[model samples]
Target: METREHYFNRINRFGRISFTIFFVLIFTIPTIVCAAYDIFPGLATVLKATLGLFLILTPIAVSEIVSFVPLLGSGASYLTFETGNVSNIKLPCAMNALKLAGVQPASEEGEVLSTISVAVSSIVTTAVIILAALLLAPLAPVFADPAVKTATANVLPALFGALMVSFLAGGDAGSVVIKGQWKAIILPALVVAVVHYLVFPIKGWEGVTILVLLPVTILGARFLYKKGQITVTPKVAKD
Candidate 1:
């Protein structure tokens, strides 16, 4: 049997190793691949565009996702890496990116207000863009052929596959390799996949799949927490 000290040491080591691998796989690999692709010729231009877009759109996405499931809002925020005081609203990176992109800043007071205003405007802009896309979807024939539409639909699955590969490449791969975490990952994944494809087809309720699965995920997480199976501690100070 494992001693308590041995368990603690293993947990700490695994935590560090897991997060280090996670960061390398998620961020570093993506950066390296993008660089290799030469998708954007100029690094400076790409950086500016990426920062500006992330800053302007992330908050909006956070808000929308939170609105769907208020209980998971904190999780969503954590996933998106949002920082700074939301009330005071400082977006330094975004501001700098905008400036680099030749967008003039407003006055000092305007800078503070601009952040809030832009975040709010982002929601409206996203909605308009979605609506415009939906309206124009019927004109797909005029813009692109059936082959292009099929390719566009496949992008989501491609991204999902990449994410799965990344997760497995860096996550508790040792445990999973030994089949310890396979049940955990497979159960949830199968539930989600089945609900998305099969249940939605039969029931015609896309949102119901999320509603059914999220609670199951939460319950599974609680079970894991109780059994000392999963531990996710925040980097912030705890009271």
Candidate 2:
């Protein structure tokens, strides 16, 4: 029986080694390409461009990391960084795995389960991307259709809505806050609406959807929980 400390120790070792490999592979190719072409884009310009990118992405990235870590656990965190689609694909896969296994993502058992699930999802996603690239030409007509385009664009909303519904619908589930669902959903809904309709129109913040809503929703839930409006029993916490 592995203790919690042992699990984290192993995870920490694996994370460092894997990320080192990932970092090397990621940067080495770009450096090699520049050397091959004898065209090093100016250092100052590169730094400037990188700074701009970092400024734009840093807030979103930080928000995502904070929001997702509890749900993803340590090993899944490593896998998630390696895989690009955190919000869209990998998260749902990990959450579903936890749900099926009857474990909370923050639990000791969930760490191993989430890691395995994320690994499988990463493989499938990679394979699908490769297949999509190969079949893109043949599938062009299908993707070109307005219905398909509409469905693709609408999928994210549908996915989140379904997830919210699942969380709210589990009234009998002790882990789910029986009375807390509405405030959690509504406050975030308002926040998202303001961001999308009001702030997004101002330009430069279009990329901030779940990133902003995640914190707002959590804050709202915390407020409700503190006020005794939301009932999350200790038994539920263990769940």
lDDT (CA) per prediction: 0.47, 0.79
Best lDDT goes to which candidate? 2
Quote the RMSD, in angstroms, for model 1: 21.0
lDDT tens string, model 1, 82-174?
332221122333233333332333333233333444455445556766876987977657557778778867865775565455443322221
**Against the true structure, what is each candidate's TM-score?**
0.34, 0.81
- Model 1, stretches more than 4 Å misplaced? 1-67, 71-142, 162-185, 192-203, 233-239
Clashes by residue pair, model 1: none
Predicted structure 1: lDDT: 0.47
In model 2, pairs of residues that clash are none
| lDDT tens digits, residue span 1-239, model 2 | 88899979999898989899998999899899999999889989899889978898887677677778888999999888778788888888888777676677788878888899999999998998899899999999987999999998998898888776666653433244355656667887777677668765635553466666776788998988889877764444433
